[model samples]
Target: MTAPTDTPSATPSTPPDLDLAVLHHLRGDLEGAEAGYRAVLAASPDNATALNNLGFAAAQSGRFDEAVELYERSLAIEDGATARLNLGNVRAALGDLEGGIAELSRATELAPGDPTAYDNLGQLLMLQGRIAEAEAAWRHALAIEDGPRLRTALATAVAATGRLGEAAGLLHQALTLDPQFGAAWAQLGAVLLLRGDVASAGEALANAKRLDPDDPGPRRHLALALLSLGRTDEAVVEFGELVRLAPDDATSRVDLAVLHLSAGRAAAALTQLDRALEAGPDDDRARLHRAFALRELGRLAEADELLQAIADGDGEQADRARQALVDEAS
Candidate 1:
């Protein structure tokens, strides 16, 4: 959770009550903070800092709607960057991505030197799938304050645009700045895997897995890396662990099924494929692999029927199915 910056009112005359309220807010005493802020507001309704702090307390209490109202009131009283930033975050939490972006953009303009506004704007843009704009925002933030978190964020947007080499360099820079950043290590592993540097990818992913044992992402990528390295037994073990971690993931089940089929364990492959299909009935990969498993088990008639259906479809799986049919006939 990003900490809220309940800045003191920029007014020349700072009231002691308002100062105490800020202290209460910092101490996590939302009730005391609210009472103190309200007391200040009673004396000076136009106290923008008090209003902003009250909004922060409301947000901490999960009263986002109230926080939005208070932030808007604070902005109307005095157009401060702090209120705009808080309002932007609250609006994003309320699922108003465009509103959040607008407020954060304004906050950035109001405080051009503040990196937090740019970082937040980048995040909202990323959520909206505007990758180029997100990268630009993060780049601006990085220019203001070069940090590992910002670099990692920029690398993510960079990678999304197919600039894998540039993304890898950014990740390396972030790791150098903070080697303990598991997310950067995981992202570096993914980029390396995409570049077909499976050995390096596996090593990075293993480090990520060791650092964050509960994260399934590193485990999943590590399994794929091991599979690409032709360490089938190790891949199977990792995939098995992945299955345990995310049982409802049809893609992981299909991957495990593929590994089973490659190892000539047709029965085991069929079981995993069945589960995959159950989880995602429209999964063409599971159905295609199931046909191969059936064929391996000498269920040629069922296999041909399944393959014919898939062959009539339009996709990579369909092309593979058509080729399988030709092979069977030949």
Candidate 2:
């Protein structure tokens, strides 16, 4: 998991009781932390520090509503950037995107030098489809802290704006900053693929796969890159790995079936398609591929029957099925 943008820490003005509570929170002793904060609140009910720390504890325990109330009370006593940031995240978690953005924007104003506020604001903005605003916020964060994670985030925003070349450059810089960053490698590979550099994309995606072996995303893209490079066998291997990582993903199963059919492994393709259809019975693509697999297995009657059903249906798949029937008859 990524480290939190803001961590609660004891400041110079922090009271001893609040300081002890923070230590308990840091040690994962939530019950003890809450008790400690409650003890402080018993004597100082309006204590902003105690309220903020307690709110943090509540948020950690998935009590977003309670956390929001505590944070609001804390902010009423004192408007601090930390409390504002926490409120923003909790509000977002509770499905209040506009409210979250409002709090995070205030957090940025409260602490202009704090990169965490900018980074978090950018994330909320991105979620709202305000890509240009998100890019600007991320740029502010990058200016304050030149880190690989920030660079990768900025690269994603840049790529969304159709500047693939600049996005690739940012990803390259991120890689230079941290060579072991798997996400950067994956992003860079995807950008390269979009630029039509299949071989380079394959190399980058391979590195990402090696770094995070269980992640199906790099494998999925790498399979396509290998296919584009005419390395059908390698693509098959990658897609097989993807299937293992995400067994319930019917799309990957269909993709694997298509590859198997291309290699004349009709029986193998049929097995994958059967599983895909079982997982998603309404999947027309899988059904269509299954028909082709049947044809390759010399079950022409069954294949023709399935094709006729699909051709009688609506949309692009039906069109393809009609064409297949015409070709088979010809």
Candidate 3:
């Protein structure tokens, strides 16, 4: 169906069409919202609200550069904090960590004490392996909030930095504050694993799975805990179930393949890795695992071909492939 085709009739308040787009956004119809916003922009390129919301819509749709342009336009009209924050989010999502941090740094200048901004910084720092800076950001957020998500972020930050006990405590606190928080339970399990508390880790992971049946995180953690605890058969069954739940999640499939390899089931691992490769034809991660599994199975020629494809920049595995070749030579 077409939009209402209504245009703004008055000034000082937002356009009726802009309101409709926000409604569409609330209903999670991003495409519908995008269409509405684009129509509004056709008449008014300098509509800051429309441009800001449209940039967010584009970012959600994976058109990061388009989102960036819209954000810049919106900021040019008026220095909106959300526009800067979203530009930073899109930049981080596109793997430009330094650029993302720079954008966020500017956003902080605009709104010095925004918790969401700091929280975003923490997540980006974590991704870039800047554990110390990530922890500092999360702690700054903590001074303002003990919300479940903030706690979960704190748990991830601390756990990544080897503070497993503190991480586990934070996750447990988050879960205790809201027993239905699946993400907190999942993180708690992961922290427990780092502490070598396999049994408790399995329990917390099971709770996470129960709380959110659609989430794959708990299953993966449970599989890992089982494997580390010498329950290989059980771990294999759990990993197999993960493959069924998220058939196209290449990373989970790689975890399953690793489990199979550890259990001396190279052929089974190869089959799983093949499924991952098929699902993500251009995924360096799947290719890297396949090459290693093939090497272990004495298929050196096939492994070399796969690694060569990686080294030739067939995908994002060039760095990993080059390193693997070096390791092989040594």
Work out the TM-score per prediction.
0.80, 0.92, 0.71
TM-score, candidate 2, is: 0.92
lDDT of 3: 0.82
- What tens digits encode model 3's per-residue C-alpha lDDT throughout 219-283? 98998888878888888888888888889888888888877887788898899889988888887
79-144 in candidate 2: lDDT tens per residue? 999999999999888889899999999999999999998898888888898999999999999999
What are the lDDT scores of the predictions, listed in order?
0.90, 0.91, 0.82
**Best-to-worst lDDT order:** 2, 1, 3
Q: Candidate 3 — number of clashing residue pairs?
A: 0
**Candidate 1 or 3, higher TM-score?**
1
The TM-score that candidate 1 achieves is 0.80
Worst 10 residues of 2 by lDDT: 1-10
User: Residue 124 deviation, candidate 3, in Å?
Assistant: 0.9
**Which 10 consecutive positions of candidate 3 have the poorest summed lDDT?**
1-10
Residue 38 lDDT (model 2): 94
